[model samples]
Target: MKRAHFIYLLLLWCIPMMGIAQIVPENPSSGALQSVQNLQVSDVPNDAGDEINISWDFPDDLDKSQITEIRIYRSTSASGPFRQIDAFPLVLDSYTDADDDETGHIVTPKDTYYYKIGLFNGSEEVTSQVSEGVSPQISFFNWGRLNVFIILGIYFALILYFIRASRKGREIYIRTLPGLEALEESVGRATEMGKPVLYMPGIDEANNIQTLYSMVILRYVTQLVAEYETPLIVTVGKAFVVPLAEETVRQGYMDAGRPDLYNQDIVRYYSDEQFAAAAGVSGVILREKPATNIYLGSFYAESLILAETGFLTGSIQIAGTGNIHQLPFFVVACDYTLIGEEFYAASAYLSEDPKLLGPLKAADWMKILAVGFIGVGAVLETFGIDLFPRLLQI
Candidate 1:
């Protein structure tokens, strides 16, 4: 029993000694194996002064077997009570020091900082000499986004020029859109047939750009309806769009000098659920048997359900949306359809307001310029010439 106790104590003591032997190198000269090469520290460019870059080259005579990872230590002063901030595998020789961790060592633009790179083995660490001071700086501009800046400047300039020209009564030639042309006729037919006209601005929320675009067209549609004194129904899927639709209809009637004819019940809110909204709009179509049905905005799977139901009601359907997948259904079911960009440009076309026309003209010219650039870039790249792409890099 005494011998067993002695053996246990001996094993415990020997294990600790072995660990210490591995951790503390028997020869102090082992550090020579991890000597850092051409250590460099500098401010990171194109930044808001919250980061600095530290870089070094591995020694040519590095022992890949002996090293596991490299650790980064930082301090505000050159001679530091330094604390480690980061660690990575030995294969990497660079670090970007940022205040990602809100620890004791903070990086800021005002203070010059020092760094040390330490090569860590499983049990021991060999640290490099202190790096030269570097401070993060606040750059006024980043040259990397120069392409985007130039493009935006050109677009704005085009917009401004067209606006001035339009105000001066310069005639901007606009192509006729079929779906927009049928809007007035649709309302007129509804008035003649003594049937209601249904308009659904789509299943999208009020904030969507497509919904906003549809609202512009809605103003035009309501104007036509108000002129004919026909019963008009505007059903919206989202609650947020209810008030917007109501106000738009009210304003349209006022614009047509028929505000007294406008009733609050003209615009109604259906369910928020996609299919549920489709069902409600479908129910409206079956019950009212409207002479005309107009759909504009973004939609997904429920587009076909709405369009098909209106088609069966024998309504002269007019459909427009930015969603490409829904275009196929609208084209087959609707008498007139506006695809993609046409739907966006319809508001400008129908209103002829300079504020809207100016941007439309600018966008057309921008697309022309873009196509030219793409063609030129493709040819240049085919011939191994990189000049065009280099100028437009973003």
Candidate 2:
């Protein structure tokens, strides 16, 4: 099976528990704090057993102005030798202690420990009773990100289902990309004019996502040009991309059953410098005047320079990139453009391979799910109901 890498989702952070305090064990500390009730210690949940959570209550009659700071103390035994772990202002009533404390104190998973709280004035201090035994327990899965994991599971299932269906000859419908549709027209025009086609796979490193997608599209284009026996030129910017582009071009020729037409020098190397590569490639656009010009991959400032130069040469141009900012320039200059994820979907669209098609279809389903979630969340928010938000807090 030809496996394609599934892209990741951007998840937001966990909800903060700033104003929440826990049940009391008893507070004996005082400066002007009469009864600092409910000093409790527990394990920090949904973590790798690396932290302990301590919380205390802010009493109704507490005089905040008279207190200088609140302090936390930790020890292995309840008998003696307790050391100060943290001190913070009167505003906060909770702290999360990590195993990597700067005091060289270490707490292992399932190790019993005791904690104490202290109140301090300008010159005097008072201490609280030690908390009961608390230990950090390692959790394999984070309950905070439970919703994200659930969504991911459903997405994977959809992918697997589609893959099996596709393999069994079930047809999947993916919307057509105009940029891709124009490739045939571009090649046909080049063949008619007896002029070569020029392809630039962006200026960034080959490992970049945009560059990687560009390579896939490049392979498809190479095969098209090979089938028509039209000359193809692949120009690259980064030094590392030279060999990859060469291999892809070679593979494309062989896949089209025209390996004899493959030329090693067809994939040319420019410079690693951004503008320098743009200038060198622009010179080729002017000199060769290729009938079709295709630019795909990660691009920066040089995007407009190359596209504009190709436009001036009156070539049938098609451009695609993941960079949104550069899309405006490509849209203005090129006859057709692949916008954002359209470039990513090219591999599945061109090949129709079951492995790639499954993921592409799964992503579409995920987007539909996302839109539904957003719509429901908005409706609930209008009614002052926070069911969806609270579900994420778990």
Candidate 3:
């Protein structure tokens, strides 16, 4: 009986200690910040439909000194398996949950979502009550792009006004392009010498803007060549350019009322290999001893080779390309070189068609306006006036 009483008392004493061991202590960081209140969610205004704005009142009783960050969470329902959206400092009272392509959010319209803002200190998270459901709706028009819309309207108006004026028989004067002016002289020289005129319409694909511009100039050149009855030899670098160039040459002959003299074999396709085409064109120059060489199109490393060959053959070379790096080669090797917009302007100056001339005149006016604005902006910057530059940013 004595031994049984001693064992029962020891068991009683050990039960209290085991209970104490099982109890977990509360985290001190849990109460570091008071909960956020009055959380608000609304649709973002004047935006594409995949955005929503979130805002909340900062907790009044929070100790900001101890707090590190406030985290945001989003879910489809109030009883959520919530996912973290982002984190912000305690100073921010709002956030925008918009689709960020760079972040791979990939947000879509009309999907309702709930949000929860969590107050965090160290590793502890103390969350606020879930926000009410919010959904994004598509906006009909974006007012933020109003400035761009106005600028485009002004540009179109300028073009239309100039076109209408041009049609009324008002003469538009274009600055002279020496390279374009030499076209007539070169064709005439070839005619007088009884030698062929060699023309190379760049090696780039037809879709390139520079190549397209070259074709436009070529169309005008063909008319002159046909009128002078000068033999024209066009060597192409791409197979796709062959058909378009042939048609352009044929049309030019027809327009000149000398369709019978149009030769289909004149526009020939050379190898697409850059150096091979350059070598072939160089051989043609040496063999035919052409009096004039016109190379207008996109050019790469082969620009200097062709120009040098033509220079050696004593041909009056007129070359035009937008490639800035290759321009110096043409300038040194060719008789006259068309730089930058001069190459584009050649088509308008040569055609003198009101349809083309009007846009050209408006473009010139636009350039003048741009230069004037730049000059004014530079002067205003000295006075700490930033409004002028800011106005042109959009």
Candidate 4:
């Protein structure tokens, strides 16, 4: 028993010594076998100043095959329990250590940090001397974004020019949109048939640009319906759009000298749920069988459902949306469809207000300018003159 106990104690002591031999070099001079030299530390420029870049030179005489791993460590102090920041293949000589955690959450900012590179062979590691301290800083201007600023400035200038010219009473001419022209006919047919006209302001809140444009067209449509003495039904998918739609309809009636004929029930707010709103609107179409169905604004998969239901009701359907995918459905189901930007241009066409017309004219001119650029680019590309492409690069 004594002999067995003595052997067991000897084995435990030998195991720890073996581990120490593998992890730590017996001769300190062996660490010179692989070395990192001329270490550099600098803050990254044109950034929020939360990153430090570290670079060094690997010993040329060292055997590259023997180097299995390289690690980067950072510390706030020279005498440090250096935290391992990253590990990479032996080939890498540089690293960027952002003053953040692994998940990109900021841990330290404006804090001076020191870094060291480690070369590993199996369980053994040789560490280089510490680098000079670095602190991250923010720059006032990032020249990288200068090109974006220039483009935005040009666009805004163009819009302002048109707006000012319009205010000065310069008449801006816009060709009549087919969709706007058909509005009168739709209202007239509804009036003759003595059936109500149904208008859906899309399935979006008032904040949406598409919904705002829809309101602009709604005002005009309401006026036409009031003038024709036809009952109008406005169903909206958002509660926020309800009051806006109601007021627009009321104003239209007032403008047409038919305020007394207006009813609060004419404008209804449906559920915000997409399919639910679609179903509710579809039920309205089937039940009331409106002579005219006008759909304008943002739409999604439910677009086909609403348009198809209106088609089955034999209504003169006029649909418009910015969602391109749903355009095919509307084009097929509706008698007339305002495709993409045509829907936006319809409001300005019908209203002819200088406020709207000026912007419309400016947009058209901008589009012409864009086409010119494309043509120039194509010609240059054909001739192998790459200068134009480089000029466009930021």
In candidate 4, how many Å is residue 250 off? 4.0
Task: State the TM-score for model 2.
Answer: 0.73
Clashing pairs in 1: none
Report the number of the highest-lDDT candidate. Answer: 1
What TM-score would every model get versus the actual structure? Answer: 0.77, 0.73, 0.68, 0.73
* Candidate 2 residue-wise lDDT, 144-185, digit = tens: 898989988999999999888888888889888988888899
Q: Candidate 3: minimum summed lDDT over ten consecutive residues — where?
A: 24-33
RMSD after CA superposition, every candidate: 8.4, 18.6, 9.1, 9.1
**Residue range 198-280, candidate 1, lDDT tens digits:** 99898899889998877878888888888898999999999999988988999989999999989989998988999988999
- How accurate locally, in lDDT, is each candidate? 0.87, 0.86, 0.86, 0.86
Please give, for residues 1-394, the per-residue lDDT of candidate 3 as tens digits.
9999999999999999888767743444444567789999998877788888999986665667666888889998889988998987756888889899998984567578999988887778779899999878888886666777876787778889888999999899988888988899999999999998888889988998888777777778888888999999999999888998898888888888989888888998888899999988889999988999999999999999999999998999999999888999999999999987788788778888887788888887778877988899999999999987677664
Kindly report which residue stretches of model 2 are placed more than 4 angstroms away from their true locations once superposed. Answer: 1-37, 58-72, 85-91, 99-107, 117-128, 191-196, 202-209, 229-243, 258-290, 299-302, 323-326, 354-361, 392-394
The top-ranked prediction according to TM-score is 1
Alpha carbon lDDT at 330, candidate 4: 95
- Model 3 segments beyond 4 Å from truth? 1-75, 78-106, 113-148, 271-280, 286-289
Q: Against the hidden true structure, what lDDT does model 2 obtain?
A: 0.86
Off by over 4 Å in 4: 1-81, 84-104, 107-109, 113-134, 139-142, 254-262, 382-394
